[model samples]
Target chain A: MDLNTVKERAGPREFSPADDLPREYREAATRMIEFHANSEIMGAYLERPFIRQAPSIDRKLAFSAKVQDEIGHGQLLYRAAESLGVKTREEMLDDLANGDGKFLNCFHYPLKSWVEIPMISFFVDGAAMRRQATLRRTSWEPYAHAMDKVCFEEGFHVKHGEDILKELMTGSRAEQQRTQEAFEEWWPRIIQFFGPTDDKSTHHDFAASVGLKQQSNDELRDAFLDQYIPKARKHGLEIPDEPRIRERDDGTYAVEEGDLDWDEFFTIAKNDYEPGLGQINGRKQAQEAVQWVRETIEDDATTAGGHAPQAAD
Target chain B: MAALENPADLDEREREALETLLKRLADDEFVLAERYTEWQVRAPSLESDLALANNAQDELGHARLWYDVLEDLGFEEQELVYERDPADFRHATLVELPFEEGDWADAVLRSYLYDAAEELRLEALEDSSYPKIADRVGKIQSEEAYHLEHAQNWVERLADGEEGHQRLQDALDRLFPHALTLFEPVDPDVETDIVDLGLRDATLEELGEEWLSIVVPYLESLELELPVSSQVDDDTFEITEEMLPEKRGRDGSHTDAWADLHDELTHTYRDLGRSETTKIMEKPE
Candidate 1:
């Protein structure tokens, strides 16, 4: 279909692999979905260590399950992106390994301890969920379909994270203090999770115009602040003074953009942040190490008339 | 040979035997799950990663069920896991060994060996004198069937190619002896009581022989050699002193890796000075 007609027809679940989408629409949707896919993987990578380091067996099980869910989300999203025909899953994954793929800025920083876990799991995930809930109406049908499952499973992750936060905050003075400190450190990054304001988001206009983006950055950020700020305070965490978030007369919230480090956010967006490079390279090394297995499987598939080996009944 | 219907009915001797058997079952599942989780995001493909993670969670759930049975003896999660001494764990040495990076072969081969033994062990416990143990066996065995299939599928595919075959061979050589520790006695008297009391119908010797009978032929079919083939005589697998690792976990001895792993997993609990463990799921019935 022509670009003008595509724009006119763009709506929730409007586009599918079968659609005769214009190149511009396809490329834009691929970029947006690929970034989402990469973030899921990187987020899983960040939380992988905690599956081992969890304080209790139940917590370990929950963390492992949560991380597993994130990887599953990545798998779904890559397929959605691949359906756009702009790039294959391997190409996107290779791009991620090579540091050309972009993902959420919040994941770029290192998560050092259990105290910091809730900051990512609860607060950052809370923010992502606010945005994701809106994307259930995205123009890309497969992307929206993936979000349906992701949003279903993500509720447990956020609640589990909040459970951790509640436990830490209610514990001894040392535990409470460490948790508060972790909050202060991560609070700004959590605010930047929605990215720069709508004005500064380069692709926002085109994405929104095509109906691929369901909500603007500022709108999503406001929604997140409205919901999570009270939840954080309820858990006894003091919101950091910086990146001043102001409550509007209408009971909504907004972060002062000037207070956030957009320069650093942009650096991370470019995959140039130092700690994030470690995360990317570590995953790359793991991917490279297992290259032989994939090759072996691929060769086996060819020998067996292109059918992948599956679990025995 | 009749089932012991209630935990309250056990005498001190029976209690000790039941506890020993429970600890071995729980510890092996817990430790193997711990090791399996190391492959969470590092598996060769997304599909493989999800499959391995499912197996890990299944093993952990089995561990929780066994530990819950131990709770009837008045033990708590903190006392049983977090604050427990590393050497006190009764898992086999094979479950404690760390995987080398990117060794998908080790992951697959280890699962194959462990799950093969697990199937035989679960079958032996299917008619346990302890009613709780017998009841949980069917649920655990169903999950284990998938684990065994997953491992066998990968092992078969990997063993089909030159590079994959070489990698599988290396893993088999390193892991086969440790796997034998699965049937090692935690204590000779306690093991004897475990069988005499009918906590398990088969003795450890019988389980070990059955395990070897299953895995030995399977490995040979894939053109892989067992490191200690000469030890298998007349269908009875004899584990000589030289074939055993110095650290037999069942005997309260462990490799240095166990201590490090234990310390890391319990770090958050200790750092926060937690007296209670958080529970997210309802206690297994």
Candidate 2:
């Protein structure tokens, strides 16, 4: 399809693998979906340790299930990305392991303690959910289909996170104080989660024009702030003073934008931030550690024709 | 034998016997799940990560059910898990052993051995003299079927290749001794009561023999070593004491790995100085 034709047909679930589209559309969709898929993996990598560290059996179970769901989401998303035929899942995962893939700005930093868990589980995931809810109408049919399941399962995660926040806030004064400190430290990173304003975003125009991106960075950020600012207050968390947020007369919220550290943001965006590099290489070592298992299984599939005979007694 | 339907009706000796059996069941599931969570993002593939995570959660959930029964006897989560001494855990050493990096072979083989015993153990409990134990068996057995199948499937695939087969053999050799600890009695006197009172319809010896009949043949079929004499005498398999680990977890003796794991899992609870553990789900009915 020509550019104008693709533009005209850019509606919800309008395109599929059967449709022959321009290279620009396919590449754009592949880039967008691959980033989403990679974020799911890195985000899971960040939260994986907490599964072992969760204070209660119930909490540990919930953490394991949540991390599992994120990996499952990655599986779904890679298939969606691969449907574009631009890159396979193996290549995408390799790129992520090699520090060439980009993920959310929030995940680039360290999650140091249980107090900081709600910061990612509640705030950052809440922000991701807000953005993902809009993408159910994305022009790519498989991406939209994947989003449907993702949005359904993500509700449990957001609530589980909020429950953790509520528990901390209602606990002893020391626990509340520690959680508030974590919130203050993580607030700006969460704000940066939506990325730079619409006009300043590098790929926002074409993505939005082609309907791959249903909401702009500015709009998603505003929507997130409108919903979550009160949630933090309701949980007795004091909003951090920096990255000054302005509440408009229309009851929408906006960050001053100047207050957020864009230099760090851009460095993370380029996968060059020091701690972010650590996150990438840590995952790389883990991936490489298990490379033999993958190769062995692959070899077995070819030699055995994907079938193993039942063991004789 | 008549069922002991109510926790209050048990005499002191009966209570101790029931508690011993429950702890054996609960601790094994709980500790195994803890080791399984180490692979959440580190599994060989994303799909495998999700699958192993599901098995982890299932094992943890089963642990929850057993722990809830303990709560009926007036023990809470804090005392049962978070504040319990590391030496108090009654799980088998098999479940507490740490996995080597990238040891997918160990993960699958351990699951196979543990789940093989778990199925037989649950079957014995199906006709338990304790109503509570019998009541929860069906729900748990439903999930165990999937876990066993998943483990067996992975083991078969890994056993097909040269390197994979060698890894499986190495893992089995290292783990077989520890796996025998699963049948070790927490207390011989209580074990006698456990069988005499029909708390579980099978004795430790019976369960071990049954488990071997299933797993030994299966492993031999895949060209994996038995780690014990494959010889059968008079239609019975013997689990000699020589096959057992020095530190059997059921007797409250554990490897150093258990202490480190115990510290890490309870680190948050101690750090927060909280006396209570949080509960995210409703108590099982």
For candidate 2, lDDT tens digit of each residue in A215-284? 9999899999999999999999998889899999998888899999999999999999988899999999
DockQ of each: 0.71, 0.62
- Interface-residue RMSD per candidate? 1.8, 3.8
Best by DockQ: 1
Report the lDDT tens digits of candidate 1 across residue range A1-313. Answer: 9888888998999989888989999999999999999999999999999998898889999999999999999999999999999999999999999999999998889989999999988998888889899999999999999999999999989999899999899989999999999999999999899888988899999999999999999988888898888998899988988988888999989989999888898889888999999999999999999999889888877887987544321
Could you tell me which residue pairs clash in candidate 1?
none
**Per-residue lDDT value at A226 in model 2:** 96
TM-score list, all predictions = 0.98, 0.97
What docking class should model 1 receive?
A: medium
